[model samples]
Target: MRTLFIAIASVLLAGMTIMSCEEKDDFVPTLLLDVQDAIQVSNRGGEFSIDVLSNLSWEANTTANWITLEESTGEKGKRALSFSVTENENDERSSTITVHSQEGTQAELTVVQESGLTLNIFVKEGAEGSGKSWEDPTNLSNALKLAITGSSIFIAEGHHTPMNIVSGGNSDDPRDRTFEVASNMTLIGGFPAQASSGATPDPDAYPTILSGELSDGNNSYHVVTISAPQSDEEQVVLRGLTISDGQADGSKSSATIQGRDFRREYGGGLIIGGSRVVLENCAVKNNTSDKYVAGVYVFDEAEVTILHSKLNNNASKSNGGGLWANNSTVFAYHSEFNENSGGTAPAVHAYPNAEIYLFNSEIRDNKGRSFGAAFYARADSKGALVNCLVTGNESTSSNGGGGVMMYDNCEMEIISTTITENTIKGPGGGVYRRKGENILSIYNSIISGNTQKEGTMNIDVYESDADPAKILASTSGEVVFDANGQIEEDAAFKAISMLGDDFTPIGDDNPALTYGMTPNHLKEIDYLFPESEKDWLDQDFHGHDRSGSTTMGATLPE
Candidate 1:
């Protein structure tokens, strides 16, 4: 019995030894990925690098794949090594390596874009009749010459002396004659119209003018002909400047024959024959031409964006006293046009084959003679106005659209806008959508307060033989407010107070605050539930809360 016990013990000991050997073979350390170091990021080529460290049995582990260092450029590369990771070979303490691949690697490379520079522009200040004074340091006419010649000129906040810009190179003289606005630049002036002293004895006279006078050290002599950009990447940004009285020099005989002819041919605040231009926070006022034209005339398939600007008090002989766009794609946002008069046609005219988009803009107080007061769109024009205000416009003798008068076969859409307070001497005060397979869609907009000399709310659809246009509206949406999330009718309850002569707004318990609400479109529900949160009232340009819940109008304080 004792011998049998000894044999059994020997067999158990042998089994236990085999089990221990198997457990030892399965013991493999985990490979750790380590990347903690300063990396070189190249902007020109979008290259970046990060070092990686691995400390484990990488040789025998055939399943070990790679160590990836993720970056914002979205690049990832892999390498497989067959070796036990030694401290010297596997530990990358301060090694830098390039990431040659930029693919689906979003790990640590989220780049947040910040706002670009703010360009402020100032034009002539001190009242309309006062000659421009240099008391304010921002008289940048001379610096503007250098800036307009290239890109990025910041006009100061002082009244500019009456000046003209003449291109140094003449087409005929060739005496080192070359003038160009050839760079992607930001020109900023007319910021807050400074107050200074210069005598403008004639109350009717303009203090500063940009006319066709090249020889008297004035630069505006060279017509700003919009030629093709030398490169597609170039941009021209005009901001915060006032352009007044850009007249053709018929009064001066010394003006170049070509220059005078160019002025006579194309005269306005800004004449566009180029592409990809942007105008923001500007005022184009009181520009006139003898021939039929517009305050802002665009042609030749230009892609123009007009934002936060005012085009007012301009006069023209024929079409488009305030704005004229021909065969172009134009987007206007947060803009205003007031009190423009046209002799022969509409205040805002779009030719055939034009695509115009207006967003959160106001068109009011415009007058025309024989046609629509606010807008006259032709056939083949595709237009859309979202959250807009078109009111208080008039026409003398004809079918006038205090809001809009579209011809046959035109396409138009309006969303969440106010088309009210418009009047006409003849027909169609609200809208005159004429005959011809025109498509008109209106959703969530107010079409009230428009009156004719005889009738009111005159929406004439297909008065002649034309296809009835479609006017669509959301069943739940209303237009008595603006897209800035306020009620338009509420502003009428409280009288708005002006802080100073600037006519900027300062809100004080106005009832016009609670109008627009888009709950489903809310980015965050917490915005409406700001319980015990501090009120951050931001004011607009006219010194009012642009996004306040207590006031009306566009000026929001920052």
Candidate 2:
């Protein structure tokens, strides 16, 4: 009986060992998540939780810096992960939290957070409530009436027109409609719907347009008129707004400016008169006029500041298609004037008493019916173009200057500016001098790739042949310098930013990257007039910090 018991015990032990080996061979680690759906967070952001289940030791990791986890590692069974997400001020984004077990079992949880939009007075199209909150929103016209000194009116995506506009002062057309803003306030556009908690707002995506198509062909004379006093001190700001489709219908009053009979028919898209205004990330475009100064008219000692803005596709009958300044001042930074047509200066025109300071801007693809496709500075007009790009401008009429023209006694300065690829039918390919003492003081700049089909190549002096050698080495790097280069072809440029031409120089093949000095304390046109716009001299077109030795032509080499 004892022998039988021992044998049975031994057989039982052997069977137990076999069963243990089989279990070890067939074992598999288990890691499971309680939730498979992704976690969602609002733009306000807050704390959140996720459930996890595992049979072995597990660890959690996330690469996103915006996410903060309560614990990184855990062991066994069902557990809850506590985490928080910060508020997103920019675009909406997403990230993944990876959960890994000791036995190579893994799970993932995605976290998506929306972008933020701030507003003091919300304006949405077809809203029935007040302008206090997103839910109780109002229209742009209503919000404009309610905006105060410190108020920031946020307009949502829609087409907004003027309700009540008058020509004022018994002018020619009293029925002309326009959106008139005359307060020290700010108008910011680009907002998702009030009920959309998951969407982000991009100005290009959700366009908030202020159109002037009042009734098809009978459009307003001016789409928007900014008459806000002290708007030049940045007291009034228009950001991410599109002003378009203005067509001048009625006649304008006549006035004498700079001792000349200057017609006051101006500003089909925007009008800044006797006040200061700021346009940031705004588009003033697609306007038409039978008179001069079609796109934007700056007059009456007004100051208009343009930052990262665009004036394009405007047509005029006489002088300026994109911008016209008369006894006023315009300071443009990182702005663009493109595709304007049918004027003396298709892009910009400064009257004898006006001044325009352009920095890190682009003048491209403009077509002039007469002279000066890019810009025209009349007698006694003075300004500066610093680190700007001028290219692809054309002139169909037989006059001068496809890029720029300087009349007698004008004083304009160009520093580290690039002028190239302009086609002219008359004298001067890049710049023209119509006799007299026109001082085009060019310093550390380039005049290359210009085509004069009927006359001089680059810089025409007294409507004669250009002295390229003298213009290249005239004082170079100094205040009274004249620096010019003829590279024939600009193959070293990177991607094209405008007019199918790349303005950014790249590689050692381009000399513009190393031919520049430090940018600071630029020379002004005058002491009392055309005051220097030194607000962003130390910054480049991309708003990158530029110090020491840097590249030229409104941008750095790639």
lDDT of 1 by residue, 1-558 (tens): 223434544554455445546775553222212222232111111222322212121211112222223331221112231122111222122222232222211112122111122232333432232122334333344434333213344343433433322332334532111122333456554433333343212212222323232344432322233432322555667666566554322222222221112233233566655456787777777766545554676666767788888878877766567777788777877788788887544467777678777766778889887667887778688776655667778887666566787875677765545566677776567677765766765544445446765633356553556554333222111224344434454334221232212212234542223333232222222321122211221322232333423222232223
| Root-mean-square deviation of candidate 1 | 21.8
Q: Residues 194-257, candidate 2, lDDT per residue (tens digit)? A: 5332334579888989888875456777787766545323467899999998865436663322
As a whole number from 0 to 100, the lDDT of residue 112 in candidate 1 is: 15
- Candidate 2, overall lDDT? 0.70
Residue 41, model 2: Cα distance from true site in angstroms: 46
Residue 201 CA displacement from its true place in model 1, Å? 29
Give the residue spans of candidate 2 off by over 4 A: 1-120, 167-175, 195-201, 231-234, 254-264, 453-455, 463-501, 504-552
